[model samples]
Target: MFKQLFETGIGVIAIAMLSWILIWMTRQARFLKAEITDSIKNALGEDNRADWGIFSLIFIAVFWEGLETALFIVAKFQEGWTPVLGAIAGLGVAVIIGMLLFKWSIRINLNQFFQVMGVFLLLIVSGLVISVLRHLDAAAIAFSHISSSTDLCGIGKNSCILRPQIWDFSASLADRQFLGILLKTIFGYTQKLYLIQAVGYLLFWTIVGSLYFRSLSQSTQLKPANKFN
Candidate 1:
């Protein structure tokens, strides 16, 4: 219990700090919503107005994301300290990288960094969609009462739609073991996924990937047109 609480505290603090860093970087990028900017800038001189407007936008965005991330870290930390430690290490590395980028005058291509991170974040969100579906399926099974004679393989409403096994890779990577745990933490991997989980995972990635690529294509087209103009 103490470990869990400690992990949660660490998670919360790390998320908050990261949120501040992200907000700062986003402001440096000059990426503020037009309405938010205009509304908050009404009282100030034009030059100072833009800065405060961006700050306000960053504050709101960071607050909301930080709260959400805190809740998420709390939930995930229950799995074990490995994830918590991993998150802490990741946060530390990010801080060091940020210091090097800013304080040490290290150069990095911001556009490329954002592009790569955008794709990675999208993949993580897709994995989350799968994880949520699997958790729901697990909950449904707990509520379901299975008789001794009942077939375990049946699907749909009349039978166990949730627990109809799709595949088991326990022989290779048992879910609770080190490698399995790391994979699961990073990619939402599972050795004993069910039919519903598989279907949901495929569907989520398909939809999100299509939308993502479409947006990228549109942006690419717009850039060339803008350049020509």
Candidate 2:
């Protein structure tokens, strides 16, 4: 019971951090390079320690990503080795891609790359919103049992006070199946869903998606002006 509660708390924190980063990255897309250059210059001051400044910038960026990855892994630890393996594979792929883009000096459309990745990540995070709510609901039920409070879960075998069950697709496409699991992992698909979970999922997509798309469009509009200048 306590374990589930702890995991749920971690999920909340992970999702919150991911959502903030997604929105922030989108909004700062245009100014991020300049900001980083400015930060490095300020950090080095008149010393003009280009090497140290570059190293410091790299270290901080890597550390920030590493911290987020750790939190994400911990939040999804109960899902078995799949998430862990995926994370490792993703890191490997990212490293290779970084080498190709930078070390090899391969030309690629970074704007398109980031835009696509942003949308993909947004979908995944939105799904996590639902998953987190489910975890919270399960934890609440377990807590009720420990406290011997029947009011917390209402009636029925699967009844949850968090929100009434909206749909159950287990019979047609169970989350345990291959396709179902794929969707569940990638898109946050579930065999069963609750009112609050649905609302939370859609709301996240609506709010975050709006901000991201708006920022993207604004950046696109500014590109021509930047080119002209």
Candidate 3:
């Protein structure tokens, strides 16, 4: 329980970090709604208004991320109070961290912040591959175990991808239980992993994140040392 809670909590924080980082890095927000938050501040003037605006945008975005998790819980489990409580707790932790950064006079470079957070995001992304693999593994186990067919012998075969089920827990990497479910929804997790799932996840990050970052590189402008995002 504790393990799932801890992993889930970290996962939520990582998601929050990734959200703000995306807000910072992308020059033109791909989504219309997200554009208003980041670029609006850039148009405001970096002195005081822009600074406050950036913070507000980040704050609102983080809130939205938390709210999304809360709503997801409500949608998944109609009367579940635990997910709501878990969402609040997870959001609270992220808020505290933000408060510390805002309150402290310590200054951090925007690019460096993204770089660090980006690395952390990558790590979590890798874990997602592991999670997907587990899901595929579950499918393989259930199909192979039940069926007498010898053709579906390979990992993540057609018999598995079409029907997924939990296969094992002794080596499960994901969190399970109430808090764990909250955490998983807030972050991203599956207790088990499979070969094909891991490869697909890797392709996603390698292709998508690279393209996103590449676009940012093309769009970036020369700015003062601390001003780069």
Best by lDDT: 2
Alpha-carbon error at 142 in model 2, in Å? 1.3
| C-alpha lDDT of residue 68 in model 3 | 85
Better of 1 and 2 by TM-score: 2
User: Where is model 1 more than 4 Å wrong at Cα?
Assistant: 1-88, 146-159, 162-166, 224-229
TM-score of 3: 0.42
* Candidate 2, 28-147: lDDT as tens digits: 777876787887677678676777868887999999989999899888778999888888899899999999988999887778888999999988988888777878788877777767
TM-score to true structure, per model: 0.55, 0.67, 0.42
Clashing residue pairs for model 1 = none
What does candidate 3's lDDT look like per residue over 82-156, in tens digits? Answer: 657766687799878788779875566655566567656655665554554444445555556667765465654
Residues 18-80 of candidate 1: C-alpha lDDT, one tens digit per residue:
434443444344333445566666746546657677788899998998788678778878999
lDDT per prediction? 0.61, 0.82, 0.57
Of candidate 3, the 10-residue stretch with the lowest lDDT total is 220-229
Q: Can you give the lDDT of residue 215 in candidate 3?
A: 53
